[model samples]
Target: MIVGIDISKKWFDAAWQVDGQGRHQRFEYTDEDIGQLLAQTPEAAHYVMEATGTYHARLALRLHESGRRVSVVNPLVIKRFSQMQLSRVKSDRADAELIRRYGEQQPLSPWAPATDEVLELQQAHGWLNDLIGERTRLLNRREAHAHHAKPNAFVISQMAAQLQQLDGQIKTCERHLEVMVKKSFTELFERLLTIPSIGAKTAIELIIVTDGFRRFEDVKALCAYIGVSPTTFRSGSSVNGKGGIAKLGQGRMRQLLYLCSWTAKTCNPACRALYARLKALGKPPKVINVAIAHKLLRQAFAVATTNAPFSTEYA
Candidate 1:
């Protein structure tokens, strides 16, 4: 048996295939409703749903705890899958049916929740990201006001106070993150720092994004998830296009890797050699930077997997 669920903030639409017959139902987003649904599902049944942010977390967790197989797919994958259907109709019920069909027809890896420590780190990282974004917005507004012909004194004062408060909050979040990393991911944190150009912030981000490196199967999988993997376009003989990194994965992780690549190219020997060779071949700077970032990620993977610090001579 296979079950598919379409999740929303208030409720979820569920569909299932049983003995070659299809069934559908709607449930409120609550523990009681989830338990009721689970009670009727077969013990060996597989549950599938899209990764709809925090909305899907509770359901997935509950299903997992009940010993049911669950697959939380990416939303992009689901959207593309929907396009394959001939009907153009769109609704929650239709989406649930498609998801159920997707699970029945495709092979998917089972989903696993991260450890409590990693989850905490992820939450802390989210807080830090939000605070940083707020700070950037405030700074941009302050800059715009400063360039005015006659800046308002009151506005400037208000902005200053808000900026100061944000700065303090940001610092506190950073401290909390540091303490969490040290306590929960001490070895990985220290190991990542040993890599050239990787600092505390990058290490924390990597740990959070990779879920302590438990989310991916290997280095290439990690690169693909980070959107640093090169993608090639080819359609028959005439439609061939240039290869470039696919920007379909985590944007923030890619951005951070790109920034780290700038420093890695100069300090990391392997990266430096790769950069020199690419530059000699007249590759564009952006392409070269992405390549460097890819190399750095591979190195991080190697170090993390092997439980060893990065060493240029042995690398």
Candidate 2:
């Protein structure tokens, strides 16, 4: 048996098929409601739902704790599947049924909960990003205020105070994240740091995204998950398009990797060689940077899987 679920902020719709007929139900997110939903399905049933941010997290965890099999799929995958099936309806109930059909036919890996430390690290990382964004916005607003014909002293002072507070908070969050990584993932973090141009922030972001490098099996898989893999467009030799990244995965991670590539092209031996080679071929700056980022990921994965520090001599 396969059960499909569509989760929202306040409620969720669940659907399953029995004897070639469909059954559906909607329930609020309460312990009783969740238990009731579980009772309707068999113990061996496979549960599936899209990874809708925090909306599906708690329920998925709860279901897992009850020994139910759950597969949290990427929303993009489900959207593509819907399009292939010619699914025109967009209601929650329709989505639930579509997800049920998808699970019934598609192969899905069983979901596992991330470790407590990793979860905490992910939360801290997100908080730090939010703090940094706030700081940027405040700085821009303050600069705009300062350029006014008659800037208010009181307004400038308030902005300065808020900026100071935000700076302190950001530093505190970063410190917490560092401490957590050191305590829980000291060896992996230190190993990643040995790679040239892989700074503390980049190392931490890599750890958070890859779940300490346990989520992916190889460098290629990691690149694809981070959306840095090269993609090309050509159809029967009649239509040709410039090559570019797929850009289908973690946007934040891709941006961070691109920023790190600037330093990597200078210090990292392999990345530097690749950058120069691509530059001689007249590749654009952005293309070179992305290639360097991809090279860095390959190096990171090599050291991680080998359980050794990065060494150019052996590499």
User: Every model's Cα RMSD, please?
Assistant: 1.7, 1.8
Which residue pairs in candidate 2 collide? none
lDDT (10s digit) by residue, model 1, range 1-315: 889999999999999977778899999999899988988788999999999978999999999998989999999888888887664878999999999999988898899888888888888888888999999999999999999999999999999999999999999998898898889889999999999999887887888888878777789889988989999899998999999988878787888889999999999999999999999999999999999989988988888889999998866
Model 1: what TM-score? 0.94
Q: Which residue segments of model 2 deviate by more than 4 Å?
A: 143-149
Q: Give the per-residue lDDT of model 2 (tens digit) for 1-315.
A: 899999999899999988988999999988899999889999999999999977898999999999999999999999999999998789999999999999989998999899888889988888998999999999999999989999999999999999999999999998899889989989999999999988898888888889988999777889999999999898997889888998888787888888989998898888888999999999999989999988888888888889999998865
Q: Ten-residue segment with the worst summed lDDT in candidate 1?
A: 80-89
At residue 74, give the lDDT of candidate 1: 92
Error in Å for residue 297 of model 1: 0.5
* Maximum-lDDT candidate: 2
Give all candidates' CA lDDT scores: 0.90, 0.91
